[model samples]
Target: MTLFTDIGALVASAIGGMQADGILPGGLDLGPVTVEPPRDAGHGDMATNAAMVLAKPAGKKPRDIAEALAPRLAADPRVASAEVAGPGFINLRLETSVWQEVPRAVIAAGTGYGRSTMGGGRKVNVEYVSANPTGPLHVGHTRGAVFGDALASLLDFAGWDVTREYYINDGGAQVDVLARSVYLRYLEAHGQEVEFADGTYPGEYLIAVGEALKAEVGDAYMGKPEAEWLEAVRSFATDAMMELIREDLKLLGVRMDHFFSEKSLYGTGRIESAIDTLKSKDLIYRGTLEPPKGKTPEDWEPREQTLFRSTAHGDDVDRPIMKSDGAWTYFAPDIAYHWDKVSRGYDALIDVFGADHGGYVKRMKAAVSALSDGRVPLDIKLCQLVKLYKDGEPFKMSKRAGTFVTLRDVVDEVGPDVTRFVMLTRKNDAPLDFDFGKVLEQSKENPVFYVQYAHARVHSVLRKARDAGLDVSDTALAGADVAQLDHEAELAVAKKLAEWPRLVEIAAKGHEPHRVAFFLYDLASDFHALWNRGNDQPELRFLQEDQPATSAAKIALARAVSVVISAGLGILGVAPVEEMR
Candidate 1:
């Protein structure tokens, strides 16, 4: 049902036919030939580089290939004409009937209109929003959470068996600090004042956890030393922080399928087992790394340690798995975590990390590669910072989060829908400026409002058609005379609808969901442009009060636009409002 893919298949068949007819050599690779929308709309509905890409390999001039391929493509009933453009590019102008079928198809399919089976049910593991359980999510984690969740949804729409996951860094020294901090709060909860010195969390959020601890165990080990209550309070505090994190995620509508804990690898021998697997591949060795560049050689000393040969798998340097003191470094558990994911039989793995973790990307990839032996591909996406603004100035931090704005603060300011939509307006690696005042503004400058307004307009048209005693149901709209939608304004909206399936596949393959947001904005712009034209031209209006047949056809087009916008918003994990208040 993907028109672009169907046309691509037809083009491939024509190439094979030419080869069978002795016009071109058999078994030539046709993978590079692409049938896509032309860069210039004046070119045609679709353009192909088949002739230009195949000419050199097929031992013929590009113009000759184009001249021969043009008639072959035109033979299809859908192609009204196929013309050779400059430099052997062939542009195909499809029949108007072909474009008209798009809305009917959309009405028939509903929200499933743009869904594609491009992934073929491949299992994909998406690990995102894996901030340490030390505190509630911040603005940095907010961006990663939105990006990773949207990306997973986009892949799911493209037919992948997607697994959404979160990795909890509950085993690190940070948790120890958290335990001590909670202990201080626990002491304070027992009617004793405690000081939060350096290396301890000072956020007021821990106050409730501390009180809960006091309730759970009253006067038990209240005067004990660090060794007596450290482990118990650490476990208790990590659980509390994770609960807070989950609530923060829920506020933004992010739900993870699984939460893997780094602590799980500690006593389970998983870390040792993963390191042993790499050792078998000769990827592990005892080596002394040279001092980091730009550091004084006299101030730095190299010591032997267990290291992973990460350079063999594209890392710039070998990474240490164990420290000089024979303790496992932070990288050891990470390797085990990825190894566990690899052993789960996922076809692909993706990690969404904050941009500050940029240095860890290559080493993590190397570990996964070594463990999986190149059987699975790992993609690491780093989300850059988000700058929050209000009234053209940056918003202040939350006192509860100590130094940064909490995810809850952002969500509470603007509801979840606005927060999610605004978060995805920019690419993951690009810094995003989220203006609280600007996002809520019901202007075209705000894409969330613009897209939502277009959807609401479609519903308004459908309502008008229904009030005029015309059937605007999907079943009736599917049978409407969309062929009568021949006006340039009507066809322009249909053409935009036609790009949905193609856009889904493109976004899924590139692992970028921001493309869906961009496509929705363009589609919304086209719909609004058409709607504005109706003010001057009565024929372009969707609601023809006196003519039921004409109104049904026009309503079918409007309903199709909503169907696409809803589907795109669904992929972005944003709700499509039926009406704007």
Candidate 2:
């Protein structure tokens, strides 16, 4: 019910009918044309660029084609009239009943109103928030975590089979650092003095890991060499950090389907296998890359290394698969990880990365392309940083390994519902300023509160109507006298309801969940505006004395608004607050 199907289908069918009737040229593709809302609401309900797109191809004036197409489009029962406006745009107005039945359709569909089959049930793999297992997730990871989780929900709502995954960076030097840090804490737990080095993590989060090591084996590794305890501590610390991460995700309402490990890829020869695949295609060879564009490292020297011909697959330069010392480079495991995703038979792969990782996008895409032979499409989304603001002042927190503001810090500040919804207020690539004061404000600018308030108001009206001896339950509301919904303002709300389905498809196609947040704000605003109109015009109100029939129709419209709000909030991982506290 998000989009009125009949009107769009009729208009498209009319174009086909014109071709059959020979009024317009046959064999011309009319699909590139689109029907969308005009910039000015006064222009019309929907506008199409049909004539303008076909003007050059059809060799007819834009105005002439619009003039000829207008009458045929208007002949349909739903179309009240069609106007050829500026640049030969075809503006359309549907009949009153066409807009009026939108509410009834919404009640019939319930929460499924805006659900779309755009993804065709294809499998999509989304990987995000793959922060190192060295410590708890920070605020930067929070943005990506929320964005990825919501995007997966959005794709699922749009009919994609999605798998949410987190990649643990346990195989890197960072994990070794994590082990050393935990060892220092473990010694302190045993009443031994230890000094943290410049590279070591210093935070209270590792205290639990320190105690856990003590509990597992007392005085067994007190004086052991680094090698004797390094592996054990790395294994123990990684598990502890991952548990902390899982709890943080739980607080934010994000449930990952899989937690992949870089450690597993290391010992399983996955990196070697992926490199072999590249070698078979001659994409891998021993070579030396040029020094990084502007700055050269102090240790920079020309040495032969195993390189992946990423340039052949669209990267700016070739990427090394192995270092000069014949050890796998960091990019090697990443290539294998993506190769694993491609081998899983996913139709699409989406990776959410921090903005700093923009340079890795091309090489990652090239790897997926080379591995999948360009069959599987990979989309990389880079989420810009989220600046924290509290009490109208700059808010800064730790970003070091273990001392940072964990994901729990955020979810604890604002509840998960507010945390999730407020994070999506901006596009992923755009910077987000999360002001503590503004987000919780009871005003229109506070989208989280405004949208939630709209839902609460609907419930309030429902409660009032139920006590008035009217059956206001969803079943009763669905069977109400919807035909009585003839007022312009009432039907206007219904019109917004009809656009839900169409919006879902558009959002899913673009991999943008922020569009849902924007649409919800617009829908809530419309509902609120209509509610305000009732104060001046008594007949527009939801409750009418001695008129249960009209009351049912109006309440049905109001309830439909709440139903949409609930569904949208569910997608954003926010619980629809029945009562605004």
Q: Residues 1-581, candidate 2, lDDT per residue (tens digit)?
A: 54445566766787788778876787777777888777887888888888898888888899988998899898888789899997799999888877777777788888887888888999999999999987788888999999999999999999999999999989999999999999998999999989999699898788888989999988788999999999988999999999999988988889999999988898787888988999899899878888876756765777777789999999999988877677888999999999999989999999999999999999999999999999999999999988888867887655434556667777777778888898899999999998877877899989999899999999999889889888988788888878889887887788788888887778888999998999999999999998899899999999999999999989999999998888888888888977877
Which stretches of model 1 miss by more than 4 angstroms? none
Question: How many angstroms is residue 270 displaced in model 2 relative to the true structure, after the best TM-score fit?
Answer: 1.3
lDDT of each: 0.92, 0.87
- By TM-score, the best candidate is 1
What is the lDDT, from 0 to 100, of the residue 223 in candidate 2? 91
TM-score of decoy 2: 0.96
Could you tell me how far off, in angstroms, the CA of residue 261 lies in candidate 1 after the best superposition?
1.0
- Collision count for each candidate, in order: 0, 5
Candidate 1: clashing pairs of residues: none
Error of 2 at 429 (Å): 0.7
